[model samples]
Target chain A: MKGADRSKLAARLAHDVGKYVARAARNMPPRGATPAMVAMLATDLYSLAGGRRASAVLAELAGPFGEGDERLATARSLLEEADRLEDRLRAAEPAAVERGRAIALEVQSLVLDFARMVASR
Target chain B: MRRLLVIEDGSEYSDFARLYLADEFEVTTARSASEALRMLAAESADAFLFDLRFDRAEPGTLVGDVDATARRLFGGDRGRALRYLQDQQGALILAELRSAGHAQPAVFVHDFPERRLANLRQLYGSVAAVASFDARAIGALLSR
Candidate 1:
């Protein structure tokens, strides 16, 4: 992809992921909707962390921004936490749901922080 | 220093301006189109820095009419129309500014295609865009 296209994709992904994570943190779904919500969130997290588009965009961004290793490490950490939360939520444990919410909030913060860093570059 | 008004639904652009462009420009911010117009009516800015997507903005503060947009373009799907408005809010805001007789140079941090950028310049005079939030690039665009 061209440089402009790459930057556009990276910024769009960052904004989208930040919004999704923030929403998840703000509104925990009701009991009946929890499964669907968790599934959707998990899909987003997985895509953000490991999907081809995301990886490519992040790699391109990492080079120009010179935060390649740190950005990749952060994505890996988020992916692991997302996996653990998905497993725990499968059991329908109340504590697991709370933990998931907390994680979402943390992820949201991190995403915003990353965005700010990118913006200030 | 030249005065630059950063307009967006959030603090990102203004924060970037303050942190990165303070030495070259005096920065002011408005989070909605109405607020920006009001500011412009009271005082002039040498340039504008716009954020294209206003996803975090409240529905009411957005520049376009959602219902009308849905009816005209989205087959009456309000959800899609709202998203469209949010995504294009910056340009809509520019349209408003132009209509209101504010012809200051406007810059966006977006990778707009050549044709689209040309269209914007045609529709709204003195429009420019950069691909990302590089302070140097944005500074150069705004300075011009």
Candidate 2:
């Protein structure tokens, strides 16, 4: 696409930061949050990669959520896995960052895949 | 007291559930699946109430958005991706549960989407009894 189109997509994704993060303990539920929140989180990561195409950004998640599947349960499992692991770490309990980060990575991948799916769809 | 485990994702519905079921069962609440599993791993609970909507713009939506975007990208044939999304969520839930080693657990839920209970049942190798805890009255009856 054109440079402006690419820039707009980034802005569209990056536009909402606060609502995206939702300041909730991984142990806390995200019922009050929306799909937009997750979308923004995905964008934040994409921005770090710098000038990546939307499809390129979603490389990690293309297999699962990237196809517009949103597999809520799978996503939930991934999200929960991350949250639980982190909660243990932050609370000074026996935390496994690797395990949690693995889950987070899955989520990040899924989110990127999702963004690509959205753009492609 | 019959024990109840609430696995929610930090949403209004989770509290809604706790409020209704707390009267009858010894309710232990976990906003995320991981927290719920933590409780489960640590102790024994009679039943579980899991909220499938874990995070906002959850994986499910990502799938849908991708499908939509792909349709735009390819200019048609979006159904395949949508189908994949529907099946994958159930697969993940089952994987998570089995990986967590939850036993023949009865589940109470509202939005499981993609009709995963069937797969969940098959994975459990037997039918897991499921109930709707969406209404206070129904929850009251089920908790009994």
Candidate 3:
């Protein structure tokens, strides 16, 4: 990929991940996101930014939400975990990546089921 | 008298709920989740009515010029504010109740985004019963 394309890809990834983080932190019901989901999201983000700029992107998205909010607190914690996991996966072999994918799918299933229930009601 | 807890951040809505339900049920009001939990600990209420959005937003937030991207994602100021509350304090009182092992009392949410009701239920593990701010819904819930 050319320099410009790479930058654009990084930007898009950051923007999309930031939105999901915001949704999970701010809009997702409490207890809705499991630790695995957080980890997976972080992994995706870490890969997209090659672990260096992921943290900055997350901070930009979640930093403005203010300090006392619980959602913000959760997002911050998740970001830290993602950062750590990103480092660990890089140092070791990429094992948790597959597990994280399964967890993400499970989370998606739960969300879909909930959405269906809501639609029926 | 059957006891009722009204968890609303708005004073006018709290007062209206108290007056409206006072004749049939002993209505107690709390302006925040913390207050509501304290009240619950002090006395066992037969039912609860919760306002979806509480007054928990940080000051100086909703006033600034929002970026076009944010506005597109979350809509206007009110929508953004409501989303914040729902994410932070939404269904908190109910979560507390469930955590306390109290049998789910006759509970209803007032003025919540209907679209997100299922989301709340997903977090709390039960369908959210809807309630209006009016006396009629209050009476009906308590009557059942």
Candidate 4:
């Protein structure tokens, strides 16, 4: 992909991922979704987007969650997965950007599912 | 480790917070303003997190007679009473702390909307860093 196309894709992916994350984060219980987790995800996304100083602040603001809580773990995992995909999208690696877009869709879907589960409970 | 004092009504919520924050902060929990005051008197905390409503209802000084009517209208549920208390006492407690020569701690108010949080910011915003309940906001305080 051309540089402009790549940058546009990266921005779209970030926007999509961030929207899902915020949606899930708002609905999940405090245990499942925390400010720290949100902050960490923001930091991860920022770092991927080359905002090193901003990422540093976010990293510090992130808090810990219970390791044994399944909901919290699931949220954390999704965030980490999104971060990885963001890395690929940011790098504009040969085949990875397309993969990142695919994963972004998948992650958003999973996050919506997660939000529904919490809502039901 | 940084000392963190968390004032929340529910044990489960406090426990959850402890689990999340224990790695970086030495966490202590209190359920009410009175308990928190006692704790503060004993030792200082590096930062503070307060749930806007505690489980128990304590009489508030600010909105005086209106509290009783509201409590009666709501069937005297402690949740409503406690919210009244939060608005009344949360500010008072912070003011008390400031007057006592304690260095104002980073304060995060949870379980509250931006409007209520803003009330706090209006009162103690200059004396301390008042923020809404976000881990990143808390983290920003910690970073400072």
Candidate 5:
């Protein structure tokens, strides 16, 4: 059985979302989105801002986590980090967008390793 | 023989898992993600065991990246980052498997004692079972 979890899609960006806080965190005047929610939007941005090759990770790296109340703060912070990470990908001149995907993949592998630790438990 | 693949990094709990599960399943345990991927490629294990932490850093990557991303998100609703990481792992594993050409393989998450299996079932349709990392939980998943 190799289907993706419909309940918990990897968000193509972040993945360590806790259900508790997402449910608990609420907003009166909700911002754009939470850190968890905007992870997907970030994916869209990563794709559109950089284009197909740059945002190739549109499929696997959508991010996750955070709450409704924390959407703006979360989105802003992640967007900042994404920019820095993109800089790393674009190191040594203007790099291809897939460079970010490569970076995301490598990082995701580590995440997978850590996940193995928990599943074993 | 029932086939099961356990991907672990030599945790004490993994040993308990083998002790408890070896009798019931033709258990094949791999200590690394690569090893597990190989076994999965060659075998149709009924279940998969995934852990969200590792000691050895992966080639061409740093632990800080995943850690930083995890901390920023995965707080779930309660701000418990680690638990959030593990839960997200459940989703990622299945996604990778699908990309790799596997059908809907039943997944068992044994890390959360307080976290009910139903919660995962509600969130992730493919989750077969979730328990406090006990043999009984594994058994229940396999039963489905």
Candidate 6:
């Protein structure tokens, strides 16, 4: 894709990811989310990690913008962590939900950072 | 550049403004109503930008009395009242700003329903809103 198109897509992804992270944070943790709630969050995180959309787009953009981009690298690693969190959630681990929430917050910050990078470009 | 004051519970809106609106606006940010008021008292701004949902804001920093709202609207359910306050904190902050005699135009990046949007305009003069973080659209609203 062209640079302009890539930037647009990055912005859109950042917006979507930020919104998802906020919603997931609200539904998790000290609010006393149920096991089913954690499962649902895990399912969505699975999609965000390697499913057809977000990961593919991130990989494509990484080719052009990822070089020497610490934020992009961090975002990629965090997504990998998200994937692991999903697995732990599937196993119904005790601390997995809280861990997922922490990952979601990190993802939210990185999404904003990604948007900032795209806007600067 | 016009000075734009952004108020939100988190840094997203302010970060966007700095990254995308920097050429058109000199951005200032506040994380709560009291902070915004203090900033306004120190300097003037050409416009204001608000984030509608403040789910991450500290409870004490949030506007509106949770107890009062619970009694009046939520059958004394403080949890529900607290959620309502977080959901509507942006508007509450704007109300405080208005009461403080700041009449600058205020903009929000939210797609409020028609009636709700109308109500906001009715309550707060010089209010504007767009549905998303399109920089050009936001700049236009702020410039207006």
Quote the chain B TM-score of every prediction: 0.97, 0.54, 0.63, 0.61, 0.59, 0.98
**Residue by residue across B1-144, what tens digits does model 6's lDDT show?**
689999987666776677568899999999999999999999989999998878778889999999999999999999989988988999999999999999898998765556888999999998888655657777888888
Model 2, CA-based lDDT: 0.42
What's the ranking of the predictions by lDDT, best on top? 6, 1, 3, 4, 2, 5
- Model 6: per-residue Cα lDDT at residue B95: 97
Clashing pairs in 4: A35-B135, A36-A63, A61-B139, A64-B20
lDDT score, candidate 6, position B69? 98
lDDT of 3 by residue, B1-144 (tens): 888776655443344455455677777787655666677788887776655444443323222223542466565565564444444453655676667765444445332346766676666654345422335654675566
Every candidate's lDDT: 0.69, 0.42, 0.47, 0.46, 0.41, 0.73
Rounded to one decimal, what is candidate 5's iRMSD?
A: 13.9
* Higher-TM-score candidate of 4 and 6: 6
TM-scores for candidates 1 onward, in order: 0.59, 0.36, 0.40, 0.41, 0.38, 0.58
List A-chain TM-scores for all predictions.
Answer: 0.57, 0.39, 0.39, 0.37, 0.30, 0.71
- Regions of candidate 3 where Cα sits further than 4 Å from its true position: A1-121, B56-83, B86-88, B106-115, B119-131
- Cα misplacement distance, residue A71 of candidate 1 (Å): 13
For model 3 chain B, the run of ten residues with the poorest summed lDDT: B57-66
After superposition, candidate 2 runs with Cα above 4 Å error = A1-121, B57-94, B111-116, B125-133, B136-144
Clashes found in each candidate (C-alpha, N, C closer than 3 A): 0, 36, 0, 4, 44, 0
Docking quality category of candidate 4 according to DockQ thresholds: incorrect
Instruction: Compute the DockQ of candidate 4.
Output: 0.04
Q: Candidate 4: lDDT over CA atoms? A: 0.46
Worst 10 residues of 5 chain A by lDDT: A19-28
Candidate 6 Cα errors over 4 Å, as ranges? A1-121
Top TM-score: which candidate number? Answer: 1
Q: Positional deviation of B55 in candidate 5, in angstroms? A: 5.7
Alpha-carbon deviation at B21 in model 2, angstroms:
1.4
lDDT of 1 by residue, B1-144 (tens): 789999987665675577568899999999998999999889899999998899889999999889999999999999989988998899999999999999988998775667889999999999998654557777888888
